[model samples]
Each structure stands twice: as C-alpha cells, then as structure tokens.
Target: MLRMLKKMDGVILFVLLLLMVMSVFTVYSAIQSDPKLGNHHIKTLQFYGIGFVALIGIGLVNYKLYIQYAFYIYGFGIVLLILVNFIGGTINNANGWIKINDYLSFQPAELFKMILILFLAHVLVKRKNSTLHFWKDIVPIGLWTFVPFALVMIQNDLGNALGYIVILVAVLWIGNIKLSHALIALAIVGVTFFGFVKAYTSYHDEIFTFLEKANREHWAERIDPWLVPDKATSKASWHTKNAGLAIGSGGITGKGYMQGTSVQSGRVPYTYSDSIFVVIAEEFGFVGGSVLLLMYFILIHRMVLIALQCRDRAGPVVIVGIIGMLLYQVFENIGAFLGLMPLTGITLPFISYGGTSLLINMACIGLVMSIKLYGQEDEDELLMGEQRPTLLERLWSMVKKEKTTA
Candidate 1:
C-alpha cells in the first residue's frame, strides 16, 4: 500500500500532506476553546483519512478508465448541483452544500470541478488538429459546461459558477483552439457586457427589470456594497477590514501561531475558511505568506510539467482543468482578503477547512499519477487518428513525395 502511494507523483503527495497538516492546525485554532469546533476537528480528520486512502487507490488505476465514465459522472454532478439549489442548506448566501446529516455536509460544487475535468478530457483527447473553433468545436462542450454554471448561478453561488468558466477557458486554451474564434467570442461577450452597463447607467428602471428577471436581489446587493462602500458598513466589509488589520498587526516576523489578536478574538470573519490566509499572514507574517505562495508555485509548476509529458490529450486536458480550479480559488480568496475584489466566499484551496474540496483535489492528483504511470514514452508522437509509423513507412512516403515533385 505504501509502495502504491509512492508510485504517484511524490511532490504532489508531499504538498498535499503539508496542506492537510496546515488545515488541521488552522481548524484546531478556530475551535480550540469551543466544543463544537473541537468535535468538528475530529470529524474532519476522520474524513481526511478516508479521502487520503481514496486518493492512493485512485492513483493505482489507469486514468483512461475515468474517461469511460466521464459523461455519467458529469451528468451526476450537474444533478447534484440542481438538487443543492432546491434542497441544500444555505450558508453565506450560497445554497451550494448538501446536508448529509446534522454533523456533516457535502458541497456538490467541489465534486463538479472533478467531473468537468473528466468530461472535457474525454472530448478533447481524440480531437484531430488542435484548432478548436467556436461553432464547430467548442459549442458542444459549452452546452454541458454552461448548464451546470447556470444552475449554480441560480443557486446564488456566483463564486463557484465563476470557477466553472475558468476551467472552460483553460481547457480550451490547452486544446489549442482557433485564435480567431476566441477573439470573436470575446467580442460578443464584450458587447453584451457593455450593453448591460450602458442600460444600468441610463435607466434606474432597467436595473429593477433585470433584477426581477433574475429573481435574485443578491447581485444588486453585492455590487451596491462595492459601489457605495461608505454606506455598506456591515459584513460586506467585514473580511476586508479585519484581514487588513491582521496583516498590519503582524508587521514583519508575525505574532506567532494562536497569537493573532484578530483571529483569536474572532474579529476576522470566516477566518477558518475564506479568510484563513489572513490568519496565516497574521500569525506567521510575511515569512509564512511567502512560503505558502512558493509552495503553490511549485505545485502548479509540477502539474504543468506533467501536462507537457502526457502523450495523450486527455491527461493534459485534465491537468489543465485542475490548474484552472486552483488558479481561480487562489486569486479569489487572496483578492477578497486583500480588498482587491469583493468578498467572494471562495476557499483557499487545500488550506481551507473543507472536506469535500480537499478530497476532490487529492483525487485529481491521483488521476495525474495514473496518467504518468501509463503515459507513453517521450519520443513517441501521438498522431490524431493513426497508429505508430515505422521508419521504413516514413522513408517510403518521403521518397514518393520527392518522386512526384521530380
């Protein structure tokens, strides 16, 4: 069993372990004095153990098998998202979690990321000529991607829905789609966005009309706080204000773990989850922040290296999808903490205390290991729709072309 785990990418596994350790520390700090948090800590650890086992087990298998079930898994993921919208528990204005019981809950949006990767890999792996065009190549994939995004949006979970768009763009770029098609699509999106802005500026009535059609005042409220920040003195600015104070209080070296005044005093809202990075910054200061950032750089670098070595398109596409997920989460979380963006309820990837997110991320690493295990040799070229070519066959083709030219 140990050897099996070792067979996967060792760097990824090590990084994962480090992240898990960090999360436990954060969780412990969050609820060190409270019974509820202490109990949650135990439950979270147990789930993490199970997730680790699953990750290793998944790595031992061939990744191609995942491709076979991609569609079904993707379908199931969308269904779960839909279910969460109607019946899921609401926390932080986003109905993205499915209550499993009183003690545990699962976030379908997290699972949806993995499922999207599998599905995209299946479609793009066998694609001939990496030139993906919009109407011809991307539209079909967009249909599947958009449905889940729309459903998540309806649930008022803009953060996760935005994450889906990130994955789609990353995969499409990796697949080497036609550049002209991308420009055209961008133009269309730009035009629509401009129109909406103009309408909002010109008519107050249009804003109400749009809000009524969406059936959610949350969008307007979310922006109102940002636009007229002076009036929005509630939790709208809670994470931003507290996180800044935490960073300022730390100075250069840090206040030491559990010594963070803001975090320990519960002044930093969502410190255990969305604003966890702020806690790290406050306790460990710039030293810890730099180390965490460096770790992420190394992790992303390894993932890219794996993508480059993959002989099959599916493996590369999957890695690309994973990259997208990580990138969005990092930027969103950090940006929110720094007040660079609105306080979007996004987690800090492996560092955030979410069982579902952590498990799915480790599972993705397992899949990457499978790709490496079964990956073709570096020199072998994967033709779009053909078998390996013999040396003689290649020479004969070259000779025939020369003769015809003569």
Candidate 2:
C-alpha cells in the first residue's frame, strides 16, 4: 500500500491542493458578499476533505478493473438517470438531482460523465487501435453516448447534457476516428450551427413565440442573450449582462478581496456557485484570474505528460477523455461569464462550490492517478527476463485480453 501511494503524482497533488485553497478562499469571499451563500466556505472545506479521501481510495484501485466492469457501471448510471426523471426534484432550471436525503442529493448526469469515459474506453479498446469504421464503431458509440445525452436533455440540464457530447467527440478522436469522417462531421456541425444562428436571428419573434407556446421559453432566454442581444428582455438577459458588467468592473488589479460592488450588491446571480468566476475576477482582477487559469493549465499539462508516459493503451484513452471534459467545463463556465459562450450554468470545475462537481472531479484525478500507478510496466517486468503477473495484471487478465495494449 505504501509503495502504491508512492506512485501518486506529486505535481497533480500540489495543484489540487492549490485549487482547494483557491476554492475555499473564493467561497468565503462570495458568502461575505452574498448572505444567502451562508457558510458555503466551511462546506467547501468539508467537501475538499471528502474529495481527497475519494481521490486516494480511487487511486489505490486498478483502473483496469473499472474498464472491466464498465458495462455494469454504465448500466447503473443510466438506471439512476432514468430514475431521476420519475422521482427527482428540480434545482435552478435543471431537474437532474436525486435527493438522497434533506442535505445530500446527487446529479446522475455528473456521475455519468465518469462512467461514459470508462465505458467508451472499454468499447474502443475492443477495436484494437485500428481506424474506427463509421457504422460499426463510430455510429454505435454515438448511439451509446446519445442515450445519456437525450436523458440529460429531458431533465432540462443543458450544461451537463452538452458535456456528454464533448466527451463522446473527444473519446472518438482518441479512439482513432477516420480523418475523412472527421472532416465531414466538422462540416456538418459547422453548417448546422451557422444555420441555427441564421434562422434564430432572422425569425426571432416567430421562434420566441413557438418556444413560449411549447413552455420552453427558457431556451430562448439563454439563446437570445447571446444571439440577438438587442431583442433580449431585461429579465431574459439579466444574468449575462450583469456578469459581464461585474467582470469588466474588475480592472487590472481588481476592487480587492470582498470589495466587489457588483458582487456584494448581488447583481450577479449564483455568485457562490456558477458565477464564482465573477468573484475571483471582481476581487482579484485579471491577474488573479490568470493565476487560476495557469494552475489549470499546469494541472492538465501534467496529466498529458503522464498519459504520454503510460505503456498501456487504455491509460491514454481514459486520460484523453478526462482532459476533454475538464477543458470543456472550464471553457464553458468562464466563457459564459465573458459572453464568449452561452450561459449553461456549468460549474467552474474545482473552484465551484458544488459537492457533486468537486467529488466527481477529484475522482477523475484518482482515475488518472490509478492509471499512473498501475498502467506502466514495473522493473521486474522490464529488467528481469520473465516475471509473474502483478496482482493488477492478474485481475486484468481475468476480465479480457488485448494485444494492442501494454
């Protein structure tokens, strides 16, 4: 166990600790400004305490065992997702959380993020590193991914719903998608998005009326603020507009910690949760924001390096999926505040004050650490001529064998 603990990545550990510090400090500042947040900073510390425990426990386990049981895990996550639709309560605009009790509820959509990666990695490993055939490989994978995507969308959780798409695309790319198929997909997505924008801008009133009649006007509320700002009502565009104002007010050095007028005034919504970036920016300014971003960059860079060094094919596949998810979450969250992307209410990853978000993200680190710990060949397997399979290897062979992997 001590030897396994030695395998943990020191760089990643330090960065998580740093992010934990940042999260706690930011949450404290947010609560000071927004009374409704009430001691979330204390809760943030407790969540981090639990997150580290999860990270260590998960890291000690062999990730191959996870891939081996990927199907069962995927089915379980899907079951919870389906169950939420029947018995869950709504939070904000999304109805994706299942209440375990009065104080602890979880979003299966978040849980599915990790499960999807494991299952997709397992599915792709069966292809043996060859270029994926569209119908046989890519299509089926898309259909598998579509199951959760469609389910999350039904819950009105657009942010988590879109995250599934991000994961599927990233995993497929690493799974060796064909370049021609990739190009075609790129073209189709581009044209579809462009056409969507065109149709919405051209027929704003008609689209708004249709959405209103369908009781899905919230969709228009989010889109109009981004697409046609002029047409968006004060109520519809209030969040984005206010977030923009708060961030812009935080010039070079910022208004100083706990001194953000906009944030303290509560003009920005969800400041403790989704809009935490606004607090960092308002309090610490561009410099503070850049520092946090640098930490994220370094953390991802370290993971990429670990993936590159991994001997097992599955290690890199899983790491790439994780990378894609983290990148998308950070981009969408901060970008929404800057108006570079539409508001999706996606948390700012480690820095955001969501229990489920923090726990899942920490577990992702543990997954990466597990790969780092178990995915490489040891000295006995390398220097010695022939050696017995280690315990992890024994468990792996029990599941399935893959010639393409290390």
Best by lDDT: 2
Q: Write the per-residue lDDT of candidate 2 for residues 1-406, one digit (tens) a residue.
A: 9998887999999999999999998888787755666889999999999999999999999888788778999999999999999998999878999898978888899989999999999888777678999998999999999999999999999999899999999998888999999999999999999999999999999999998997778989988888899999999899999989989999988999889998888888888899999999988899999999999999999999999998866888899999999999999999988878888889998999999999999999999999898879642332222344778989888666654453
In each prediction, how many residue pairs overlap at the backbone (N, C-alpha, C within less than 3 A)? 0, 0
Model 2 poorest ten-residue lDDT run: 378-387
TM agreement with the true structure for every prediction: 0.85, 0.93
Candidate 1 local distance difference test against the native: 0.77
Candidate of highest TM-score: 2
- Cα RMSD of predicted structure 2: 5.5
lDDT of 1 by residue, 100-178 (tens): 8887788898888889888887778667546776777799989879998998887788888888888998888888888
In model 2, the clashing pairs are none
For residue 372, give model 1's deviation from the true position in Å: 1.7
lDDT of 2: 0.90
